[model samples]
Target: MSTRFSIEKLGAQGDGVAQTETGQVFIPFTLSGEVVTAARERNHDRATLMAVLEKSPLRIEPACRHFGDCGGCAMQHLEEAAYRDWKRDRLVQVLKGARIECEVDELVACAPHSRRRVTLSARRTDAGLLLGFNRHMSTQIVDLDECPIALPQIAGALDMLRELGSLICATSKAFHMTVTVTASGLDVAASGSGRMGERQRQIAANFAVRHGVARLSVDGEIIIEPQKPVVMFEAAAVPIPPGSFLQATQGAEQIMADLVGQHLARAKKVTDLFAGCGSFALRLAKKSEVHAVEGEAPALAALDRGFRYASGLKRVTTEKRDLFRRPLTFKELNAFDGLVFDPPRAGAQDQCRQIARSDVPLVAAVSCNPVTFARDLAILLAGGYRLIRVVPIDQFLWSPHVEAVALLEKPRKRR
Candidate 1:
């Protein structure tokens, strides 16, 4: 049945929320203060937006034609000022919910078309290979003619990548290709495609060379390497692993590194937990001795190499250990005067508990998820650490994801 709803606010997932007689209803692609008519699904409070009887003043035209249909972005319809405020408010709300109160800095804006890394889905169709993002709430792929969120080099090569997918695709099933635009050139990595024969492998290699791709890999195995894919972390040039994790944009990474470096500047020794390719450790080593701990061996090796070749840097050591399995204990953490940790979405709960018990004076906590970040901050707060401030970074522009760097300090008791 159709129902009338006045959107009250946007939920954490970027859906519009309405307080109805029955309960709160969530409608996709809606804005606050808009009167929307939607049809409720059977046995569910969530509704599908049918019409916007009244539009919000904060609503604006989306940049991409695939805004609503493509699942890549949700808040493109919101105006710039309102959108940034909303993103920053999300981090504040999460911190309040966790009962960890602190001042939050204004949102750090990342420009569109700044994304260097993108993962696209591809499948063999009757006509040819289809490539793009999956449609909203469906498994169907939306073939892209253009994507405003991706770097121009990546967006312009959509059709060429689709053609490359056809050659690499050994089965009728769908696969994923991660394209990263590095300093050398494009690094394409394909996975979930069936094994290729020698002839097919030869064709793939030829396609990569002819198209000027820096490197190509299938299921983590390197197929062709015309040039090394090197990504600079500050002064260090680190060779990136295929399909490895990197900050969405270089601007956001610099902001995060600056915040982290500023917090740990005075310390003589620092430990970076969950360090991936030495993003923070390389920059931190400018002032302090750094020990980087990571689970991925390849990433740790890259960090070690970057440290050795880079000149005028302090001592940098790496340890390959899964922090989730073996979090550094209080005694181990006590060796470092400063610490910085940037864990994945599943935030470092076990590690935070140990840090809380330790006496590290200066600490910088970086996170991609605000919820888990807030939870971890609460632990540190309970251990008497005073939060200096939290800065929210919008690296994934027009998307729900937000990155943050939080600084904290704990004073030592006098004897």
Candidate 2:
């Protein structure tokens, strides 16, 4: 079935929404104020855009030809300013919904082809090796001839990666191939490629060396290490663990570090919660003594090593603790003058409650999900902490996801 509808607004997922008398219909690749003809999906709430009868003025040429089908980017077709506004508005809208009041800064932009890390799906297909990102909401992989969003070093090596992928591919089932650009070279990690025998592992190792790969890890174990793969967090050189969490882009990481660092500059001691491999901890150690906490032992070890090897830095320490299971109590949190937490998408509901009760003079929060960020902000606000400012960062670029750094300050009680 086909129908013509006017796009009412952009949804959270960058899908153009049209409100029918029944409910809202989500149409992808369509923009607000545009009249589009769409084929009705069996799901009823989703529609496939057949054609745009009227196009929005904000529409712009997408940088990549794979825009719609690739699933890596969503708002690439929208104009630059509008795209940024949408990202910033994501924070503002969520804050209001959470009943928290604060001024959200404009979106800090990131350049195209700047993504330092990307996880590509790979498998041995009858049509040769299929290596690329999965289709939008589908298991199907979109084999890439080129990726404009990835660094040139990564995009240009697509063919080479395919050949390398072929070497370790023991089964036809699709697997993840995470490639990260580091100071030494490309660090490639593969998982779920099926069990590999000694011969298959040797072939993969040889291919990694010939192609100048920094390191190659399979199923969470290092198969070959040609060079020590490290990423510089400000002046400190930190080793990135295999399949560790890294801010999607180097540019975005710098922006976040600056935001968190500048806000907590006055504190002599800072505790970084949910810290992964000392992204902000080491940088803060340049000024304040940092206690980095994370659940992953490998990441904590790497952070400890980075701190030990770095020169001209204040004391830096690491604690391997599962924050979710047993968050630092309010009494424990009072030990730190300043605290910064960058939790995963679920946000830090449990941790924020403790921070809220604590007398930490300054707090900086970095989160990828606005909804959860707002929820946690509400918790902090309820506990006498005043919201300062929130800055949205476009690290995911054209994707609907937005990252934010929020500052909060607790007023001292006078005697």
Candidate 3:
């Protein structure tokens, strides 16, 4: 018999931790304050839960059948309200630890199930094309017949794609086929296709003909009718390639822009760092002078196009520069009165350092990774910045990730 225990707290990755007599174990979908039975032990001294002896008040019945298997969403089992509160607590803890005074506001709730886009990996099995996400921590594919979180339209296409899988030879030679469904149509990419030369092209053509996709791309480049630009928020429409980054949820993205606009409206001039396709810059341009900086040259071109269509007036100055390699100096950084950052998972550590030490009056740091955000916030705090407002945005629902928009004001000098 395995000794079991109750979870004390939720970890950063959404795992519930419980230390038994033997050792500590991380269990998924199990909430803190819940007692569970350990089923069996696995490699790396891990233990799986057999049954929940007692459920926490924060526990909720999982809505998805493939909740544990899919591995896409880790916290759907917890009550939505409790899950959000935990996220808010994480940010508060970060600020408190640094001795920064800030009002952690209510988190913006995202639509529970409205993801219009989904990228699934397809494997060639003896039976057929296994289409779904990967296993918990392994590359082994967990074939899902249906995904609950995906938009209804995209989820419907999974069956069609799976049935059509064997008809094409792209499955045999590729490592894993990529299936992306956009507003236009489906796009597929087949890697490890040295065996199929012309066959691969013909397969794509045949797939396009059968499904009637408005656009198709084998790799990053387009192969069929060009995909129309995606309309972001309520106003801006950007022409993004298949692999290009777009906010996962269109509705949530609009909310993000609204919050940014509200914040930037107070500033006379703002600098948006890692501003891919002018996500925040173009919209802020409607009210203030926005200097958008991005590493990708093509993204800047798209940002320019968005500006031309969204607003004929050019309040945005797009600069193509790699901030990681060469961070903007304090002298150059002082040009902006306010700053908005939407960096990648790495977060804007170096860029945040530059902003803290600069003379910018107001700063807004938006990040997807909380760990890096906290670290960067500490740097800003030490440099005479006072945290005023923190707004957590649940753009990726049920997932462990949390996005936040933090407003920091430079501390006033004491006479």
Which candidate tops TM-score?
2
Which is the winner by lDDT between candidate 1 and candidate 3?
1
Tens-place lDDT per residue, model 2, 99-139, is 88778888999898999999999988888998998887689
Give the lowest summed-lDDT range of ten residues in model 1.
Answer: 406-415
- The candidate scoring highest on lDDT is 1
TM-score against native, each model: 0.97, 0.98, 0.89
lDDT of model 1 at residue 352? 96
Q: Tens digit of lDDT per residue, candidate 3, span 1-415?
A: 5556689888777888887676668877788999987755566345566788998987778877887777778888888788889877777777677676678888778775577666666667788777777766667777777766767766777777665444444535335445545555655544442244566657755766677655555555555553463546346676655565567776666777777777667787888888887778877877788888999887888887878787544487888899998778777878877788888889877887888788888788888877788888888888888777788888788887778888788843343
The true-versus-predicted C-alpha distance at residue 269 of model 1, in Å, is 0.7
What lDDT would each prediction earn against the true structure? 0.92, 0.91, 0.73
In model 2, what lDDT does residue 308 have?
89
> Any idea what lDDT model 2 has?
0.91
Provide the clashing-pair count of each candidate structure.
0, 0, 0
Cα error, residue 309 of model 2, in Å, equals: 0.6
Per-residue CA lDDT of model 1 for 1-415, tens digit only, reads 7888999999988899999878898998999999999998875678888899999998999999988888888899999999999999999999999988788999999899999999999999999998999986678998888999889999999988999999999988889999999999999999998899999999999999999999999999999999989899988989888878898898899999999999899999999999999999999999999999999999998889888889889999999999999999988998999999999999999999999999999999999999999999999999889999899999999988899999999996453
Q: Which is the better candidate, 2 or 3, if ranked by TM-score?
A: 2
Q: What TM-score does candidate 3 get on C-alpha atoms?
A: 0.89
